[model samples]
Target: METKAISLGRSLSVPFVQELAKKGLISVPPRYVHTDQDPPIISLDSSSPQVPVIDMQRLLYEDFMDSELQKLDQACREWGFFQLINHEISSKLVGKVKLETEEFFTMPMEEKSKYVQQGDLEGYGNMFVLS
Candidate 1:
């Protein structure tokens, strides 16, 4: 099979081999050329809207934790979710709980079954089902 060596810059235009040959850039050589079926078209018009920003600087500076709590409560009552800035919780405890929950769920079926509640009991009671 005969192969043609085409120039890089000439490849952008259609009939590149013929044009290159006519320009004395490359010899007229027999080769199998595959044209692009369809180049991919990307649309940048589609995008997600940004989330709303809530400012809590005044509440923090004034030491109005109660007012902030009330605001959070109101937000929960109105909007299901709200961004909080100056809230504090024990990271170690949160990490421990998360790790424990992950480990608990990943345990063997028999082992997980042992932790399952057969009846409603206090301390380890199913809070969701209860009043």
Candidate 2:
């Protein structure tokens, strides 16, 4: 039996930043740099903006569940991502994953292109853009 391939949307092929950096250019390509857009939120105070952190331990408790869930929602809405703390995953396993990901990225462009996002959501290229 054959498995069906899945695709979220089509994405335009773009050069990798690693390839661009290899050129040793002093300035980034204008297309790669955005000069016009300002951040959506600006703080008057000097404190720097921070990514929200969602504590898994707190989420597990009845007393903290509601508040923690709200934090998770706010994190997704405002920051798009958040740090997950007290997850208790094996550090060794996390390290291995990190190493493997680094190794994959270090692979030559030709080798990496084998997993190219060919009109699919699951591959190596950009994920959100649709053509």
Candidate 3:
């Protein structure tokens, strides 16, 4: 019997692997396996540093001083992305929206076929567009 070798990427979780094994798609042993031996390299001597951490709470609660604005501008210019520590958006609503979006995307093609866009008219199914 020919055994097929499978390559598991770095981001895949172990539980996913076990689930695949249970489904009999891939025959993975019941032990942790490290397929790749090469480790990621890190440069210690480089002067350029990692992304800067932004404190959103400070920006929200404290007075918006010139120094703070400068720091914010500098962060936007340098990193282009920063973490929001204290966001006001509700986590529950976000999760619900995410779930709904996933469910909508996973709907059957036949079901999705019901929604047809018409020219000029903003309506579902067969419709004519008004110029």
Candidate 4:
């Protein structure tokens, strides 16, 4: 599988978007963008209900497992994403990781390309999809 992915070709680069945006093309390329009018293709509304924020600390309590599991299940079903709080990971390390990510994203695409895995699509770019 890893060999198959590397042979598929290089992952997509966000710097391509940056170049386009510099020319005032802020939107994605046409292949990835949609303007369908038959039915609205996107939603930008924020007044709807919010995504769940799970408390990781509750998972430590065996007695609270059932209720927490119910919340986790509902969150997974409704939003498919959730923010975990109080997981005990170091906040300093988290901040450093985020900072490094920002730095990597801001680096020139040529420099970032150094991270592309020799065997897989795990890199500073998009997935195995050719687009």
Residue pairs whose backbone atoms clash in candidate 4: none
Best-to-worst ranking by TM-score: 2, 4, 1, 3
TM-score of each: 0.32, 0.75, 0.32, 0.61
Comparing candidate 2 with candidate 3, which one achieves the higher TM-score?
Answer: 2
Pick the winner on lDDT between candidates 2 and 3. 2
Model 4 agreement with the true structure over 1-131: per-residue lDDT tens digits: 35432256555544456557668875667766546534332556786466687888787799887888889999998667898888999999999999999998788768877885554555544555455
Q: List clash counts for every candidate, in order.
A: 0, 0, 3, 0
lDDT order of candidates, best first?
2, 4, 3, 1
For residues 1-131, what per-residue lDDT tens digits would candidate 3 score against the true structure?
A: 99865533223223433245557865556344445544333668566465566666667655754555677788898667765555577999889999987886566545655663423234333232111
What does candidate 1's lDDT look like per residue over 44-101, in tens digits?
5546322233446646656765776677677777555777553465778778998998
Candidate No. with top TM-score: 2
Q: In order, what lDDT does every prediction score?
A: 0.51, 0.84, 0.55, 0.71
Q: Pull out the clashing pairs in model 3.
A: 119-129, 120-129, 121-129
Clashing pairs in 1: none
Which window of 10 residues has the lowest lDDT sum in candidate 2? 32-41
Name model 4 segments beyond 4 Å from true: 1-16, 34-47, 73-80, 117-121, 128-131
- Candidate 2 per-residue lDDT, tens place, 1-131, comes to 99997756555666788998999978877666656755556667658677699999999999999999999999998788999989999999899999999999999999999998766666887876433
What TM-score does structure 3 among the candidates reach?
0.32
Count residue pairs with overlapping backbones in model 1.
0
Reference-based lDDT, residue 63, model 1: 75
Task: Give me the displacement of residue 131 in model 4, in angstroms.
Answer: 5.7
